[model samples]
Target chain A: MPLLKTENVTHFFGGLKAVSDFNLRIEPGELVGLIGPNGAGKTTVFNLVTGAYRATEGRIIFDDQDIVGLPPHQINKMGISRTFQTIRLWNEMTVLDNIKVAQHGHIQYDLKDIFLQLPRYRNQEQAIEAQAMKMLKLFNLADHAQQPARNLPYGQQRRVEIVRALAANPKLLLLDEPAAGMNPQEIEELMVFIQRIRSELGVTIWLIEHQMRLVMNICERITVLDFGETIAEGGPDDIQRNTKVIEAYLGVEDEEIS
Target chain B: MAGRSGNLFSSIFRPVGRIVSPVWTALRRQLAQTPVLAFQLGVLVAVLLEQWQGEAFADLLGFRRIPRFFGIVDIFEPFSDLDFSGILAPFFPSPNNISASPLQDSVQALGELATTFVKAFFYQGPRAPGFFDVTFRVLIYDIVVFVVPILIIAFLLRPLVSELLRRFPKWSLILVHLIILAAIVLLWGDDGGTRELVLIFMGINIILTVSLNLVNGYMGEFSVGHAAFMAVGAYVSSVMTMWAFVDDRVFGAPALDPSWGLPVGFAIALFAGGIAAAIAALLVAFPSFRTRGDYLAIVTLAVNFIVQSAINNMEGIGGARGLNGVPLWSDLSWVLLTTILSVFIIHSLVNSTFGKGIIAIREDEIASELMGVNTKRIKLVTFLVSSFFAGVAGGLFAHVLAYINPGNFGILKSTEVLVMVYLGGMGSISGSIIAAIIFTLLLEALRPLAILKWVVIPLILIVLMLFRPQGLFGFREIELNWGWQKAKEKPEVSGATAED
Candidate 1:
């Protein structure tokens, strides 16, 4: 059974329908790709699914529970987490702190425990720190644990964002242009990392990617969008051969990128 | 190598300076100490002299009890009783009385000294005979007999207890707190009398500073309407107490009419204050929860003004004329207990997961929420908790002053509380304590400056904010422990785990 599913989901901002009747589904442990041109409502779909914005009209179900009106954090607590396309991080906080913040949901310390600094507070903090460190080490970011999030290089910053989101221990991970600013070599490595996270960590990957090569390389199945509407969806070979996907990519009537 | 230069210089000068250095150094040391010593001595002497001679002058002027300062005494009568022989005696320096009746002279001198003290204080100025005199008397009754002593004890107890807390951890700390509470209750009683009033003000100030720092300093929310919430609490608790006192009796008048009604009133006052402030917080939180940085600040300021104006026009709660006769319930002990309690509560809150949520909100609200923190709930909880404490403080304030005017609960009071928080340090509980103590003292010290006090206050604030905006302690508390030892202990992973 699918872990998270969006059915006929659509979102409108003023006069523009940002995403229209966008339908997607992911079984547990399945790695899927969401590829589209600029302003194609890819992030908008992710946001709508995550309840960052109300869907103009649609239903989003996470683990068979209707998550349409739930708050973002509630959506997260329901086991769905995501990273921003522009790398939204707690800039002033240390890398470890950023990850630890995400771990707040799972903390065992209640208000009483914290206020009194009871044994529970002590145990919870220690446990969370270890977990956060392990998450950091997964991304090879243990060395930069004490450093501020903003101080890291572009690639490492992206890695930190992924690590922070993953620290929440969500079953579903949404990436919004994770390789947006990376060079070709960086993108190639990111492909492997994404696959490892899916296969080894066992998290379902739902990503919106502008880079065609990365999308074509790793995605088992691809959903293509254009002008807020789904123009194509299928295996890599089907998307490569589809005439409609070619027309959506190139402005011309019948054209495609090599 | 660094110390060797100092040693080399000192060794060379040691022999040569030994002969003349002692005398020269003594002279220079005396010269150096002169200005500081002189300034302090001058101020003390002036105050004591003013207290004495002013009464003497009043007596000579044939005034009975020079208004507020001296009691009814005729200073001029003594002078008038002196004969020409006695007048000459002052100049001649009597040899016989100096030795034989020296004891008798000392007794006469003691009477003269008392007369001098009363007279000096009396002639300084004539305050209003009725309301003014009563107010002055009340102020004196509270400050001199109560606030001063508690302040002295707090000054002595703070370091001693902090040292004990550092050494013994929790149990000893609790014992010290119990002792303080016991002492406070013993000295001031729990009644809403004059002693209670002073203690409550001191206590509330402490609470507001520490609790507010959790929001303004630790959570980093700029809240200016603290007094409005306080007013809410004061009105609520006062109304409830008044209701309980009056309604339970015939025709809604106090039945048994216990003198301790003020303390009872204050208990309800805190409850009412907390509830009302928490309710009021919802308005500001919903609209501004999604927005951070400057936007959230603007919303809180607006909420503050809204609450102030609402209270100003609120007829049921007294409106502009303000509520009267709150049945003076607080004393120094009650205030001290609550103050210590407030500090402990805030200290624990800031160190908890809930506190971490608050700090996360301050650090980055969006990031906090996105990480599955119920941001709205957290903000609401924080506001509610903060306002509840403010209400308790307000209840204490109303009963202590035995009156409540809208003007008293105005923005200025809020700013004063805010200053205490800022002066103490934003996230530092210890800083709040230090700031409250210093701020209260500074206020007393600058009282003589009158109208110029505000000008000096702002200037001092500007200087402090410029140099130490994070406050004296920043987010860290004034822990008495040696860091080296705590550091040596296998990193308290439990404490670290709690942060997450």
Candidate 2:
């Protein structure tokens, strides 16, 4: 069984259909990519999966349980975490705190321990800090851990966002646009980092990237979305050669396409 | 027309401002640099003046009594028999009382002191009339009180007081508690009513400000009707005490002995008041789950109106005439203890993971929720706790004033609390405490201003908002010498950069 399976998921914003019959299957330990044009509703699909937007229709099964109408937090607890298209770091909070907050769902201590500031609370907090520091160290961002996330360089902020998602211990990690504002050198580093995340952290990766270099280089399989519909699903080579995906990105061959 | 007036104002005062500006800047810098010293000097002056010539001043201010340097006792009997016709005569006790009254043993005098303390202080104790019969020894003790502290603080302890806040926050908190204790001791004399009242009010204000800070500052919710909760607390606790504990015209007879009300009955009443306020807060908390920001603020305002009107319409209590004949249990010590406990509770809460979740919600509710924070529950709990403390403050306030009415907890009161929160800085506990203290004193200081007080206060707030919009601290805390923060600073790990 797939780690995540969305069977005919549909969402509507008022009368407009944002995502229509969006079926997706992400198997265990697979690096999948969701590719689409600007208005293709790629993010809407991610929102549906993460329960930010509940499906207007159909079932979203994660780990064999249907999580269609659950709140975002509950879905996050079920081990599905995603980064935003634009950065959404708690900007005033320290970088370490941003990562620690993401692990809020799986924290071992209960509300009682937290309020009373029991030894367990402090211990758990220390353990979390140590763990977050470890993740930061792994990403070479340990020196900036005490700094507010917004103070970090853009490339580092994007990386910190990814580290924050990873801190949640997700089985399936969604990257909206990890390579959004990077030069070629940074993009090259990000590509290697993505590979390392898969090989070392062993998270099932699913990403939506406008940068074709990141998409074609790392993603084992690519799914294309166009105008709220899946136009193509294939490996990177097949996707590169697919005329439909090209026309969606580069615009229509004919005026009749409209 | 507005632009012309503005130009005329600047044109008239610009040169005047230039001369005054330098002096004002220097004074501000000095005050800012040595706040502790200034505060100490201010307290010393007030204590000394109240001891020395407090009665004359109190009479002018229309106060029945002025608190003495020693709170309970009016005068020591040491040198009452010695009449000084020359130097130190005014400072020493007059010999006129020596022929009228026989000198008693010092131990017997102390016995009288203990008895009077218990009788007068343990809730509704008889307060003595005003008179100062100063003694030579009393003069020496007063000098020691002034000089020892100045010498210690200015030389040996000034740096320590400032340094203690950062190095030992809990110790600093204890130091503050000790200051309150010392203040109580210094103002323990028979005629020291005005200053003690001011001190108690400051304590109550601190509670009110800190509690509101939880919701308005830390939680980032604009709750304009906080005083409504306080009203509920005030009324409920007042009703509880007046009905069951005290014999009053309204309640007629005590349900239990008046003595029981002092300890057990009064505490339960205060707790009940807090609980009742928390329940009342549901009107806002439930709405808060659905609405936020200005919408939630409107709901709070409505709740405030609802509570005030509800109290106003209740003929059974006292309606708008107000509930009087309340047992005055909130003395300096009581207020001090409760304020510390309230501050400690809030400090612990904000430092918790749950609190971080609350702050995260403040930062970005959507992101916080998506990050697995139960934003709804957090919002609910934050409202309840915030309102609960407001209610507790109301209980204390009602007891202190020995009266309560809907008018006391009106929009004006809520605005007072908001001014405090903003002046201190949002999300700053220390800021609230400092602001509350300053505001309470400012209110008392401006009493002579009458109607001008309200105008001046708003002007101060407007200036504060203009100059420091984020407030003095702005989501940060003062490194106070006090607090019960057990957690030390984050550990420094020396290591190389992460491997590529």
Point to the candidate with the largest TM-score: 2
Q: Estimate each model's TM-score.
A: 0.68, 0.79
lDDT string for model 2 (A1-258, tens) is 999998998889999998889888989999999988888999989899988888999899999999998999988888988899999888888888888888888777765676567889888888777788888888888888889888988988999989999998899899998898889999999999999899999999999998888899899999999888899999999998999988888775554311
lDDT tens per residue, model 1, A1-258: 789888999888998989998888889987789987788888888888777888988899889998998888988888888999888887766787788888777876666676566887887787887888777766677777877788998988998899888989999999989998999988987998888888778999888888889888888899998999999999988998888888778879666553
lDDT of 2 at B255: 85
lDDT of 1: 0.70
Which portions of model 1 miss their true places by more than 4 Å? Answer: A106-130, A137-148, A151-153, A183-192, A211-213, A236-258, B1-202, B218-221, B240-269, B280-324, B422-433, B465-500
Model 1: lDDT of residue A191: 90
lDDT, candidate 1, B1-500, per-residue tens: 12334888877777776877788877555444332222222333333443556456445434443422122112122222212233234444666654454456556666765564454444424531332343445454335433444344444444454454456655554564467445434433344443344345556788877767777887787877788778777777777666555443212666445554556555555667677766776666777767656786677666667777787898877778877766655667667767776777777776555566777787777667777888887777777778778877887777677668778777788889889988887777888878876786566545444555677789999998898877777766664432123431232222132111
Predicted complex 1: CAPRI docking category: incorrect
